[model samples]
Target: MSEKNREGKRTARERMAAEREKHKAAEKRRRALIVGASVVCVLALAAVIGVIAANAGKDDSSDSEGPAVAPSGAQGEDSLVIPVGKAGAASTLVVWEDFRCPACKSFEDTYRSTIHELTDAGRLRVEYRLATIIDGNLGGTGSRSAANAAACAQDAGKFVDYHDVLYQNQPAETDDAFSENAKLFELAAKVEGLDTPAFRSCVEDGTHNSWVAKSNDAFRSGGFTGTPTVLLDGKNIYQDQSMTPEKLKQQVQEAAKG
Candidate 1:
């Protein structure tokens, strides 16, 4: 063969090799794009699933079948407010509270007797609005559970007694102790005839849980951030620094007169 012909054959071979290298590089890039697309799709799907689960959880806490209907004898829009005074009393004292709130316990301990005295005399009616702000803020079910139990007590015609007992034995804010059914029944036993099987069943079943949720929703919509919010004839007296038990009683009497 001629030397030039041999060199031409070598050059052809080199050209073919370079083409094969280019094809391999293009194939690798295609595979890399495919892998990256798969990864992105998987991440998007996971994020969608995560969002769905989170929304479902929120619905479980907030939504319910047939909406939350307030129980019988309940006052206020959501029926969370249990009236504690005479049917035709002159003034309405509304109290928004959470069973697990320490400040609420203090308010109860200080003014429970005064409230009852006023109510018994038909001087004013006290409306109790239950709330579960602690559960949302602190990550637990104690407030909801206690509120359910209280509503159950309302059904059994022992709301005031149960309310007093709950505040009297309120657990620390961080303890979440009221999340237990047994503890609630035990406290119910303190109230005369409140620890019956029916009461226990109601508490265990959480029959009023939805109602409690409704109450919390009402509290949120009422635009109050904390518990023990006391209102006199729609006025927020609890916000007043000088408001004491005596002052509250005086205000009620004065309202009664006018």
Candidate 2:
């Protein structure tokens, strides 16, 4: 072969090699950019998730934060009962309730008027015993916290009003909004003169948390079915499907006559 032809062919081969190297370098840079972008996206997603988790936890009330103390005028075993109405009433209605329980709210909505009328007439006395069954079952602190807040209201002689207000504004069982102290105080504002500094302090400190816990323990030990366990003179009247508010009133009146 001619020398010029050989030189030309060698130059052409070198140029092709250089072009291939350039393409390889470009591909490596492209891969590096893709990897870097993916890492950045992952980190950003993690940060967003962290923020959401933190916000959720901020409002999640924890029932294990402090010792339980019974509220003023708390009666019955271990001072767990918050009594509404005169002590000497003819019929005693015992209620086991969870503020976060929807059934309890349903009961309240249905019989609140009848119960209040009877209580105000000094015919029936309601012994409200709080439970945290919802909290135990659903994995949250709203029940306990709300119970503690009710106990605080009991201390201020505003339990019945505050209790009704709570039921009126009870959140969904899964929402856990009552775990926030602010929400509790917000509901307290509904009860006339209930949002006192002492009340707020009591709720904030979970002053009755231990008492609430003990009440919940007692409820579990009692072998009750669920919240709104309304007993009229040792009978689970709430379980009586034929019974109504009128029937309850009649029964109470009959007992008063006896």
Scored by TM-score, the top model is: 1
What is the C-alpha local distance difference test score of candidate 1? 0.85
Off by over 4 Å in 1: 1-42, 45-63, 66-69
Residue-level lDDT tens digits of model 2 in 132-208? 88877787899988999999999999999999999999888798999899999899999999999999999998888
List model 1 lDDT by residue over 1-258, tens digit each.
999999999999999999999999999999999999999999999999999987763533342445564655897664667888797888988899988899999988888888888999999898898888888878788888898888888888999999999999999999898999988988998999989888888888778788888888778887895888998899988788898889988988887798
Model 1 vs truth, CA RMSD: 3.2
State each candidate's clash count: 0, 1
**Candidate 2 at residue 145, lDDT?**
89
Global CA lDDT of candidate 2, please?
0.90
lDDT of each: 0.85, 0.90
